[model samples]
Target: MTRRPTPLKQWRLRAASLALTLPLSLAVAAANKPAQGDYFERIATFPVYHNLAEGEARATETVAEITTASSDGSTLYYTDSPRQRLGLVDIRNPEAPRPAGFLQLEGEPTSVATHRHFILVAVNTSLDYARPDGVLAVFDIRDPRAPKRVASLATGGQPDSVAVSPTGRFAAVAIENERNEDLNKGLLPQFPAGHLNVVDLAGQPADWRIRKVALSGLAKIAGEDPEPEYVSINALDIAAVTLQENNHVVLVDLRRARVLHHFSAGSVDLHGVDIEENDRIQPTASLLGKRREPDAITWVGPLLATANEGDYKDADKVEGGSRGFTLFDPRGKIWHESGASLEQALIRAGHYPESRSENKGIEPEGIASARFGKRQLLFVGSERGNLVAVYDASKPWSPRLEQLLPTGVGPEGLLPIPSRNLLVVSSETDAADDGYRSTLSIYRLGAKRAEYPQIQSDPKQLLPWGALSGMVADRDARKRLYAVPDSYYKASRIFRIDAGRTPALIDGEIELHKGGSSVDYDLEGIAQAGNGDFWLASEGDGKKRPNLLLRTNASGEVLREYALPEAVAAQATSNGFEGVAVTGEGALERVYVAFQREWRNDPAGQVKIGVFNPNNEQWRFFHYPLDQAPDGAWVGLSEITAVDDERFLVLERDNRSGPDAEVKRLYGISIAGVEPQADGTTLPLLRKRLVRDLLPDLAASNGWVPDKVEGVALDTRGELFVVTDNDGVEDASGETRFLRLGRLRP
Candidate 1:
């Protein structure tokens, strides 16, 4: 070393140089780096969409319509009739379609069309058959079925059919005439006339460009006389139709801003029309001889087929005769056709079943499960069907119908205890009912069904009782059923069930001071901790509601009731929190509760899951970001059993309005961190790991509005058993399915 700088002076120089180089190096590295890590890739998923129609029953005035579209054969759109909501079905794997989210609509929709990324819905506001209110709702469906309504316009007449341009800039609507009605008598309108409304939607914030256009002048055939009125322009197109009458296909140049051409269907009344691009056409020359099929022959270019409903004058006339569909070629030619009578089509579509009265349909609200011996069964509750259905899942997918039983007024949730072969159903009565009373029906598992001898179906034995919004199987020594009496009443009833016979009530009842809608026991989970004790969570309405967590005895007696901290209580609502789960054991035990705040201040407002420690009796609240709101006011939670001590599973049930309401979802929560300890003293520490959704992929999957998912148990096999309360009555299908989620090894 030259002059050998002193140790302090050398250190100071080195530190200065290091600090100066760090900033430059960091900046350079940040500029050249690519995005890293996989925060979005670790999502957990389950069966949230079930499309098994084999055992479906109609339980409501509305029915589900399954529509599919694809890109590279990937399902793009899935929707239902009544709610007119759209959902994205990830059909990259056709057999196991998964739901992404809901596609919002302006109003009830009659028809839908999807292009690369655009979705078109034809909305009719006039419910009266005599009056027609035509409207077009356009959406950006580039995200598949999760279409965003970008523009809406009112077409003067009622829109009966709709289609979108190949470029997705223009939307075509077929406006049906309003039935002429007498102003004074309020009768059906006679001499109804229909027309065509072509909307230019090329630009952003698309407005109805071509406000109104008459179909009469456009429908005039060259040789045929122009009728005084256009009875109906069911087939309206913007492709090959000439200005003259013979051309039935009418092509409107959206870019040119005028009517392009009109094509005739000979004497046929067109019902459907689809247009395709030249690249999409198949070679007709190869199928038929060149002489029979000329060059530029009719190919399936954006094929649009019209179903002829036939004239209403002849009642006996086969509705099918007029139900034929006219297929339009890309070259603008009427190429192929296929369709039965109108009545036949309706029946085939399940719109008009063979015997409407005889059909026992179910509007499934939610599904849950419980286990008996080695077998795990599912219980399904229907809001509209007013019943519950049981299924045997000794075998997966192929669940056999075990029993169809009746409950009280409107059964919403069903819970089963296989150890005792006991099942419980909870009902939320219609608001119109005087008492505002709900019911819980109790049942026993009986002999196996004769047809499926291996399946164990629950018996018809039922014990019905009145209550409020929630119910749970008491974990106390009494091992009774506890319920909230009513919205105003704070008292709960504890009914003891005889373990020897059919789970019948043997003990009287016990009441609690806490007044609320629902209660959850932490022990109701898949895995049992080393300690014999389990946690219990009870929720009261937030703001005006009270929320509490109680350390209870095995017999359902309250050992200690701790009021939730203000941070957690702040999230409570009138409906209170729906479900709760506890993770960790001994001193590390923590409880997570879900609060259903439907009309919260923000859309991102979450369902609250609060954590508490049994050892310290201390608590803290956390929130999870759910994609959508809970369907009903009541929410249910399972126990906090860990896949590993660091990761636990939490089950939740969505609420429903009634039997006909669409079913909601059951979510699986993964917890991280927090390990079990030899000493049961330090509270459990947990961080949310992942959220998994379970249900079908269809819009109708909402039909399963899970009430209170009460019973969560696991057998030695590591299969998770969940049970829900069916308010009462068997679903229309006369069967319910209790769902079981098998734990996967890490």
Candidate 2:
């Protein structure tokens, strides 16, 4: 018998394999894609609430957890556990998927699988954790609108995952008698143990028999109690089951109804990863000998891929999550372990969830494999990151990351339809108050490159960056841009972006330092002066942090700080000092700051624009008229850019996102003849002209419209640029859209 490789040996082997087989180009394209080859582009997004039954309140929560498609791959069926219904969708028109309807189920549906004209649904009907009971309900899906339940077989325990064999003769369900997390901190070995339920799908549906396969004594950690989380069947009718909390993986021979082999899912040594929740994404920590408690598993030929989600935490607060994924051979030998690559890839794309660093970074929880033409593909879904990673699995031993697709809040279901060259992902998080609803996103595989990640950091010099509050083009370099982050981060740094790339790349960063130590400021805006220095604008709340401006040298060292007049600063709200700009040279130089919303003393629909003369230390103010805002939404200026000494452009937008978004535009304002006033004086309302409306550009991506169009600038070549804030990926889908618009007309 071959001895299983130790964690150190496994790590060394993987590193050697990667060093030999992985190319530099393949490594850099892991988070982004090249400008060639077929890729999946999101074509449509279906709101799960549209499938609500007639007379149902729209405010009620509905989610699409686990999804499955019909044999022909034209219709999709998803489980809505919150509503106890099975939702259906017609995808004949892949670009425009429609809600077919929904069917009320007797119990909460955990998973769904399809074989031929039949659909197998795992329903959890257990009254409590101690007494586990479930049913494998078989339905004839020939008529999807009205799927008739042909038979219901007792599953002996609460089921979590269901799968059908390729032979169409057998179906398997993982009856995971899940434990209540509140009881005893969710220690294992609770009363009734869970097992596997194999359904013999021969003859009539009513004649199907459920065979119980005891999974006890198989795991080395928790032998008495086993909670099977996910199941996948290979071409040989072999079932692969993941006992998540037990930190083990088992293979069952469905033909003989017995265990074929078992192995500990094992742990990995994670290096160069962020392991703390410090509101910063610095990947320089190590998690050695961490258990890989896999959550979802799928077979890639003779190989197995597991999403190590690490859902179990010991009494000492040590979690089993290894913060990555793993690939294993049939003999339990580790083929490859993605230690920190996935999380690093997410960080480059600005999708790394810093809030989840303490538990599981991004939380890889869903996996799907399929063959599109001759290219074998593997997709891994990140639960907290809200994106799916696609990999080329042609060489099973060395899979290359090909693309990253953005999804909703919690992407729980990943289904690939190779017949139509499409992939579907379902998100389960539904909180309308938070502006994120459960959705099913559809994608087609014909694009030359992925449309997402319009902006990303260079993978070679990876650095995590998000919350792009303001941007400004370099005074001399037309292809160079600088952006600053808001209070979302602990330390403020100036990010240097190379705008020449197809998807602009962040290649360098300059940390702002003051008094020999790094400084943490709500740096909202940045403007490069003719002397190569920078004028930084810091937004402030009415109380603690007063609105201020700072002058920084080219190396990002704070030289001086200028606070607003006490009388004017006292009447400001939290939305103060959003954008900043500079004009003229030497004694004639002046700095301008755009306040986001109206101050307490200002009139409604009008905001103040302040100008400061550095030579004289005198301040003057002018008012910028605002556009009519949509109901339940407010509009404000996000950025200010100098078109010339007397002309300027300001980015104005509303707070609503998605379909409700409006008033995102760029307006031109001039100080040609307008006179500015001092504090406690009536300011002149400057006349404004519409420069451009960014709504079409925001909607051109065919995805949800982001509300915060925070940054806009005109480069030295007269070209325009725009960027959106991701709120540092906190309670928001961390997707930063960096767009390069053409030259601006005078």
Candidate 3:
């Protein structure tokens, strides 16, 4: 999403593609189906769910994370990294999870979470380490029914995780602090240690209340608060026993308006702790054993773990570390010494006699603790082994390994839904390798065995595991699993997975115009139009250009392609647009598109959005100039729903400018004037405008630079949902992601 004076190569590609024109029949045929046996061939493989052979997994240089959610506990949200947006599926009936919708994001999203009322997302700023920052977005889900964003927040550094409080009063964010002095010497000031921030949400019925807090301050007063009183809680303390420095976790206490703690388990220069266990009584114990007899031990916890980035030995490495998890008590107490201390202790003690030499060692990057069916379990997602290691956390002081489940690529996130005895594991492909595509490994745990001392320690089988198509975006569902594919240049595809059955590819491709990247999947963002028709917004292109307004039938047939206005097109600079919502009554229906302009050298980089009147088939474009607003770059615009007639909520990018600029703003836009057409369709005429001079509010704010904004949707309550793309591009500052704004209040 980073804007770089419109590189010549991209322009050449665009010009080349535009110049080439095939015969109408040939073009139509090509679009309908890809050539058979071609590398990019389109196959009609009945969506199958099963484990892939180790050799069959495709590798990607960089595998971003995927997020999803579902209403009726049957749908799932997903995104394709290469495609750059989110997709949905109906899994209520496992064997036939239906394709729902595709929602686009400004950049690439690293993490995704969903609640009954909203979908929350954390996107990585551009892939550039020099420009580190991310956006926090919220979607309204009042309609488990149709989901959309109601509010959003901007955070410095890559956002790792987001959690909404039970009361939905606030959102706690964990921002990854990976900025180093060396990398930021000439960039803007380095971010203070990556810390947790809090967004003060307005009440449930209101829009998002955006705010931020520092972790240093939260750590200063950790003892004075209750477990759930904080705005957001950092679980890294527990994770520290296993995470590396480049992979720390931030805990925010929203209720207390402070950060509770920051845990840096692995770092470039240090190696963390490693724990092991033994159960057999060896005759050799008498030769070296002290008064403490280690013979009676039947089980062990965290048999071995370490925290550091895995590339510690590589040359030109900016960071040093391996990955592993730490241990903490139930009350959140660190059970082991620092990683340095533990590593030193393990080295001095030498290998234990009971330790097996053939056991594969792992550097875990993801850690989770949960209670399932009366068994307290600790799960470690490993980057080295690409497996999920399960442990008994019944006694946090001494966790014991129970089982290990093989996953594809580098396993990162683990979501366990005990209500259905399901485990959803997300994999991040190695950035340095190819043929390693990302995947979501779903495992069904068998009946618990009672023979072991700890419920989690008993041998349990993992059954019916499935590998989903494409990398995941955000997943949501109550019983079924929903997913979206990962693509860079195409619209995302949606799929549904029914429990105990094969998955179904509901729709074909959800077109998001030319540069769709990051994607957010929220509930209300998807809806049903008349006679099985569905309407979705393509949030404009990232280069500040018009986007596509997609209309399709229930089976995923494109009924019409509404060309957006140039004003709207100009607002979506390089970070192609996202965020689409539908509102109004039948004949007078309206669709709003949020414009996320790029920051160009021009003094007046602007954002122009479009509103379509489906009934009359006409379009009216709105212009938001950068020159008039405080911080004009409105990156991610999630939703645009009507509060009532004549009044509308326009969610925008609201935050502080990056190193080159100042304040950021997010607010609402008012709509008036309705026109009807003879065919009952609202179509916009094609009129071109200077992308840089359209929005006065945008030009004055951020000094006119192209921005990448993405994601948009409308909730069932008539609220809007918006998100931005953080392209995760290398070395580019700012998340390829713009901002995400959800409109709930009129």
Candidate 4:
């Protein structure tokens, strides 16, 4: 029952059903074409924490990894490795998803596939990486709240991915006896190779038939390892498997339980790519002959699509991983490869993970395809970037990018339910310290605009940009602005932004250097000096350097430095300067900077706001009020700017992300006739006036609200701008929002 086609170059896809809304001719031209009818919108977010029982550590780590939907699309099931449990979510309303419950298991659950009324889970019972043992368990989900494990069958290897055939009579599991990266520096050739575990489900799992299809001796590179990573069974009962570490793809006939064909996934010479892991993203570098070490594999019509996670295994070369996805035919001939296009698109959205430059830039780790309405859609998940690229693949030969949807951290699984016109992503990363747990992001297709990528690099330049911290608009230009990068990169940079663009464009970088080498500064705040220069506030971690303010030219060359007073410098901790602004002029010119969080020698619920006079090199501060803290998170001022000589704007926020994010606002204060004391500790305090609640703007995009709202600037046009820090995409969605908060009235 295989629909295997000829070589990629020989086979041609007939026009998709003409019934589709748009003619195939025009559909091919769409680049994430504007959604016509109801486009996907994130109506609800369910943190896996809801599944933990009363006695369980609610603060403990839990994640929704591999997931599957009920045939009716009303229920969702996922595997949580850290908790060693299978979780359930109810999405009957599609607008508000809630956690149903969880079932504990003896081992870590790797993948889940649903067949009829049964839920099939591959559980890894391995005691060591060298010795792997797993089992395929069938659970009766008649009562989703209390799933009953009815049967279990032993397998020889650890399973990574699983899928049930559309016929509901076949299921395939990729038994990947994965490698021990700690051993021999993760060199391959570890034997007891892996393969596919096929089961015929005529009825209950107890009465099913099984077979193990060996995947060894197929690829020349690490052929003995045969690390099968993912599997997907198409409507024709044909299964396609990806041996990621082995750099190969295999297609099998489920009816006969035999391998039909296998071939190398091959390699490519990547150009215009970012190639460093030094906390910076420079997307202009190039790589030679990088292998497409794919991870997730999905069936797209008669062809197969793979996410090139770029998990290299060839010991000969130092570099591995192709930064995109590929489509290959049964003959193993490469049909189409995304190459650098995906990564480039990510850069424009300011979602590029610069911290992974030494490794794969943005790992396209998961792929899923579905037929919704008249359109065939393909969704690709970027593990590091924390977003999925959805495509209109109705016309197989020419697919257009539709939109990028933000997920929680490490989106390990992608699920598409065409029946309900819904898309789901299972993010696997859990945050214990930040109160933000792993989440299940649900998107339903409807008549709504894709409200993401609010900020991106210019399409022409595609300047790789992320980790935005400080923001300052041009003094004269109405729509021009500049943003500062946080400590994610060793290089301190100022990015030019044309806020006028639909998706604000980052024109290019203005490198900050001292003596030609990049300056080592944790820049958190910036203010235009109006003299073709900017004043920068560096947030010293106390262990590294003292908090200081510096002035730099348009080229980002350091011109002057203003060291903090000895007493103030000694009082500085890790949470020092967070924002800076220039006020007054000439002799009366003064610079203002905000201190993040409370430090030593401060009263409870109050922090210092240092005010500096550049002319006299003198410093004074005012007591800034701190609000009541969240349950377990801390609150602090992330940015401050002078709205005018009499008024100044301050940004107060909490250090929490996603649903846990609550307070993000702009407060106003005036220094009108306020007496400044010589002693920094004796300064008077000022009451804050509410100006704007930024929570609405953040939620308007239908994306997760990030914690680090570290920049706020009032431009000469009376308009205000805000920017968020993405933390270098490290445990972050890597989404930087550059917002133009239209002219402030006060």
Clashing pairs in 2: none
Candidate 2: list runs displaced more than 4 Å. 1-36
Report the lDDT tens digits of candidate 2 across residue range 1-746. 11233322222112111221112122112222334657899888888998998899876899999999988888999999999989999988877888899878888999999989989888999999988898888899887656898988888889999999989989999999999888988898786988998999989889998898999998887778999999999877889999999999988879878887788998888888888899999889898888899999998756789999988877787673677788887557787888889989999999998888888888999998988766778999999998899988766556778889988889999999998898999999987777768989898888987787899999897688999999999999988999999988898899999999968999999999999898888988999999999999999988899888999998999999999888888898989999999999999999999999999999999999999999988899999999999987899999999989999999999988777788899988889988899968889999999999999988777676788999887998899999999987777878788887899844
Please name the candidate that would achieve the greatest TM-score relative to the true structure: 2
Over 618-707, each residue of candidate 1 has an lDDT whose tens digit, in order, gives: 655444444433443434343334444444455544444334223234344454443322112332333343344444421122233334
- Writing each residue's lDDT as its tens digit, candidate 3 over 335-374 gives 5322332222212111111121112123445555555554
- What does candidate 4's lDDT look like per residue over 1-746, in tens digits? 11322333244322223111111233332234555764676766678888887798977888999999887889999999998999988888867777788888879999998887889999999988878989888899886656788999887788778889999888898888888887887888776688898988887689888898988888888887788999988776778898888788887778878777778888877788888776666777887778888889887765688999888655565564588988776667666778888888887787778777778888899999987776778999999888899888765545668888878888998989888888889888888675446888888888566667778777887677677888887878887888888777787889888787777777888989988887878888999875768999988887767788998998999988888877767766688899998876778788888899777777777888888898888988888898777887788998888777767888999887766788898898887888555544477887898899988888766566888888776666887778888777776777777677888944
lDDT scores in order: 0.38, 0.87, 0.38, 0.80
Which 10-residue window of candidate 4 scores lowest in summed lDDT? 15-24
- In candidate 2, position 362 carries an lDDT of 85
- Model 4 misplaced stretches (Cα beyond 4 Å): 1-35, 127-131, 143-146, 316-318, 434-436, 514-518, 530-532, 699-703
Residue 336 miss distance in model 4 (angstroms): 0.9
